[model samples]
Target: MKVSCSVVVFALVFHFFLVTGSRSPPPSDSVIIIGAGMSGIMAAKTLEEAGYKDYIILEADSRIGGRVHKGQVDGNTVEMGANWLFSGGPKSSPAHEIAKKIKLRTLYSDYGNLSSNIYKQGGGLYEKHVVESAFKVADARQEFGTNLSKILSSKKGGDDDISILGSQRLFKQVPKGPLDLAVDYFYNDFEEAEPTRISSLKNTFPRQLMEDFGEDSYFVADPRGFETVVHYIANQFLSHNNNKITDPRLQLKKTVRKINQSKNKVIITTEDGSVYHANYVIVTVSVGVLQSDLIGFVPRLPHLENELPGENMIFVTVTDEESRRIEQQSEKKTKAEIMQQPFGRIYFAGEHTNSTYLGYVDGAYFSGTFRSPSDSLYPLLGRAT
Candidate 1:
């Protein structure tokens, strides 16, 4: 999966105001949705169900289904992005509901399953305690989340200024044994996608310390593609008949480049110079792409600390060749509130926005459905705060 940033804006279009709770009634003005990925498609589906038909989905890629991507190894199915379904709690997630409806086969990769095979980095089988100890590292994990929560609870906090913590810090205490090394290697490797350094731990904690797998996640290794759920969603609107879906509402290869809002209309300029006019627009792209300035907002979006790349260039920047270190960054920065909030008439949705599930497919879904109207927050697409 590629990471890119995007910007969505709401146009005033005169002194008119529309507010229904946080949502307003559907109007004839067409809605332009950028990206055909999970959040984008899901957003479109919601609009379609609400008797709103004047909306169009503009996707940058030739295909839809953004992070819910599947890969092939010798023709065998493999997940390229977001490989698992995490249950938020007792509540049946949309992914679970869809899986049950479609009878999608899923394999449970519980703690026992993961802890069973412990492979060392260089050679030899690593001992089990190291793996077990990784799960028991609650003290270290507790050192990170909201500083206020910690202070209120009288809990000692980690460094305040730091926003991330590299798992390498934990490695310093453990013995340099193969088993210990393996555990450290596996965790640090995976956490490379997320910087271990922490400024506020209220938002996240060490994954191993939490007994959350059963309550939150399941691996999808079915014979069918992992993205089958995305297919089911597309079928809801895009699919005409059982197979052929030729909905003109869904336009592919339309990469949004700029957004300029007038009093009533929002003008969207695509990379190909194709101009689209709409009464409202919903931009759903990645945090990275949004930061990369792939799509420009008329009044300009907030200032981001870094410039991220599209799928084509993520790896080059994420890796640290000199120290052989993978410089993982925490997805949502400290100042994500600025990233999320509604621009003018545009709304934003993506996994980066939902702090409840944060980084999970559920976050993507939550942001897509939860942020109905005027509730335009782009969190990761920014935290709702």
Candidate 2:
């Protein structure tokens, strides 16, 4: 059945000393941040750090924490999305620092003894040794992107850094043998996307950049509930004086129907017909939402109307019984028993992304900063039309 509810609209405008007389100034030359998800919150925090306090965050959901949803399931807290911090060292990880500052705990995964029970396609369960041997064969048979390597190593250069078509070509170069297929599955598993569909340039360039930064393979260490991290960040914005930061910003249960923007101000219309305005607006809605036109833009956002990144989402779930079974197995086999399950777009983050500690709290924390944007503002405006 279709259900509808009226959401209470609230605006908390954080006023600075620059504003003279007006209680609610006519959309001052301040910034308005849309969505309170990780990107949005980080954007707001970045602005605050940069000494900009006049901005307001508009959240369509009834609560903050966009993809970082967490709750109790079978007596254990589980994250619905965004679960682990990858390579979150002090110098490179903002999410990790935030967690430390807020006193959040983390659980580490032991990958050294990782052992997975293999369920073959033909119904029989293979021995762990057999599966490991197969995985190694698959790894060896995997074809590297020579074409991409050539382009990256070239002088004249190509149109875009990477192309979907180029990635598709590289995938085709690898033979469709069992070993090749296994390798493809493994890489695709981590990417959460089909090999042919993923961005070859984007993936390669990022790895190259990381290498330049002295980072080797990806690392997943601390895992914690992502929701806790979100709440911790949100608490910072709230003032200790009256427990108020702005005038009560953050609207829940309200879906943005359309956005009308001009150089002077941005007017956001909710699904319920109510309208809200701000001086400058930062759009942090998901690429999926944008692709579906769930939120419309008036005078239309030319640059953001049609184009979006080629990223997919993955979701995962684990029960207490399952966790126990793995622990027991780990003890008996003297091998780390962990479950690595991958789903689409809706990732189950917070201590569950790794095989060593699937569905643990740290998974969500690790995932929060995985694809974190460099500058929140740049991501908002960087979408191509």
Candidate 3:
């Protein structure tokens, strides 16, 4: 599903003025970007590069990186969210390019090695032939699920709400015994984060990581943490001191409480009782947050709507009817929401908004920057293809 990043603006437009928590008047801008994650920061950088600086980024967390955060584990810096950068996609991942430009350390991880290390419940390693046979059966079942999904998705109107389990049963590849079940869990449950019984075959089947980005997945080994790339991107547009963004354009720890949209503009109220006015608003919060009641909308958002393999740190993904439901309208929603359209003056973006590559950092990058004209970002942001 393709969507364009359009105008976003808020609450009943009027000349009435009221006392706010801040002694100073609330600031207004051409755009108010919610969330300082990959998508939000990219949007800001795009605007900044275009010489359009009338924008402010409000991030709820004290830090700038959202899910792409790093934590100290025993003295070693470790990624808490996204770690692997799939550089070999049909279109090279922009994140991969940025990592190279910034010289972020990375190590190639062979996920196939994971199978060789698998052990039995008692701790003895499984025989090579046994492991191979188990995976072969699992692979066949996945192929069955993929083919079945294509058949269902090709239906006249759209897809039928069917779980992958339904197709698996017909394929007669039911897992038997502990080893078989373990392989099943590895291929199905671990990959999709949902049991086949509940996973929508049409939406979740057909793992595409290898198909799109090749077999190699590079693990970020940067001492600064995987999120250092985001800091590097931010440094491009915002002034920074000692790796910390010191620019006034980026505001941290500002939790937006409500967004009121009017015909003329948008009024955003934060938890601190501070109000902000903007002609456009780009929301890049996670799907989990949007599905939650964390931020209220004067006019509730409109309705709308996968998993893949390869050392994937992201357990959830959202697309198509599934995308619209996860994004605009909530339907058998998961932790991830895929695509979203412009709601009034608000434009939605994030990894979830990328249908083809949802759940990846590169997805969020492209969603914020390189969409084609048919499905591009704001005119001010421009398009690469």
Model 3: per-residue Cα lDDT at residue 254: 98
**Whole-model Cα lDDT per candidate?**
0.57, 0.45, 0.67
Query: Candidate 1, residue 19: CA error in Å?
Result: 2.2
Model 1 residue 324 lDDT? 44
User: lDDT at 266 for candidate 1?
Assistant: 93
Each model's TM-score?
Answer: 0.71, 0.60, 0.77
> Candidate 2 on 1-385: residue-level lDDT in tens?
0000111101121222123213342323566566777656655665554455676676777667777776677777666665544443334444555665766555553333322544556776656676566555444433335345445545332323444335545555543555445545554434433343443443332232223222222222223466556767666764433422343555566677777766556687888888877665655555446557787766754333323334322122346987676545433132111111111111122222221112222322322222223212223222310
Provide C-alpha RMSD values for all models, in order: 9.5, 16.7, 9.6
For candidate 3, write residues 1-385 as lDDT tens digits. 1111111111111111111112233323378889999888987886565445678999999998798889998999988888887756575667788888888899987768656767898889888788888888888988988888878756654436466778878898778788888888777676556676766665555545445655467889888887888888898889999988999989999999899999878899999999999887888887667656699988876441121222122234456886676565433223222232346677766766664555677667755663522132333223211
As for lDDT, the candidate ahead, 2 or 3, is 3
Error of 1 at 117 (Å): 2.9
Instruction: State in Å the error of residue 89, model 3.
Output: 4.3
lDDT for 379 (candidate 1): 27
